[model samples]
Target: MLVDDQVPIEEFEGTEFPSPATVHMELRYVDRLLHIEGTVDADAKGVCDSCLDDVERHIHVDVDERLDPHSDRENDPFGESNVLAGNRLDLADLAQQLVLSDMPMGLRCSDECKGLCGICGANKNTGGCSCENDTENHGEPKMEDAAQ
Candidate 1:
């Protein structure tokens, strides 16, 4: 069975995706096991970790899960394996989990971001500020001290 749907990003709170997400799933049932393979595509909006600027990123996640419909729930208290509830599967939940897992730890607009100046809160990438070089270098010895 093939299922394709678009899920609104607003329904999921605490997620980075700001736009609607597209999910495509292919399910194959064999005996008591259901094998699912899918892909999730979305645009994630977040603040850049370095510069604190608004950033929009396109994210794609691959999903693969094996669900057991006839697993003994009482014996496996922890539910180590994915189990189906009755005959229904929650595709939205699965897609959300997969997307979250694939999201980057630190969202950045670019790898070469200059970030904000520590002293004056100036955006260094756009232009320079008077406080650019005024911040103290914590560990390094001063050039005058080294010469002395």
Candidate 2:
């Protein structure tokens, strides 16, 4: 059977979504295994870990899971299937878990991001801060000047 639906999820991996994730998948049950294959589309809204700037991006996750309908995922902590309850499947949770597993940790707006300043707390990518350069010679103002 073919399934088309939208799952409303608040956030994934500490990143919020601008809208619901559109799920398009094909499900087939054979013998004792249920095979699921599809794709999920979402718009992620999050802050860059480096420069702390607002970042948004479109994420597409390919979902492929083979679940045993009779297996109990709750009893087995290491089991891969957790979206199934008896004969029923939770599509919303499935989408959320799939997206969460696919998300990357510690996101940055760009690889060239200079990040924030340590002293003045300014974004280095946007023309840094004055405090960084003010302290010269490894942040020491000369021993003679400091003794005064």
What TM-scores do the predictions have?
Answer: 0.74, 0.79
Q: Which runs of model 1 end up more than 4 angstroms from their true locations?
A: 10-16, 71-83, 133-148
Alpha-carbon error at 10 in model 1, in Å? 4.4
Ten consecutive residues with minimal summed lDDT in candidate 1? Answer: 77-86
Q: CA lDDT, every prediction?
A: 0.72, 0.82
Give the clash total for candidate 1: 0
Question: Residues 35-112, candidate 1, lDDT per residue (tens digit)?
Answer: 889888988888888888888888798878887766633545346233344456666666666776677788887989
Predicted model with the maximum TM-score? 2
lDDT of 1 at 62: 82
Give the top-scoring candidate (lDDT).
2
TM-score attained by model 2 = 0.79
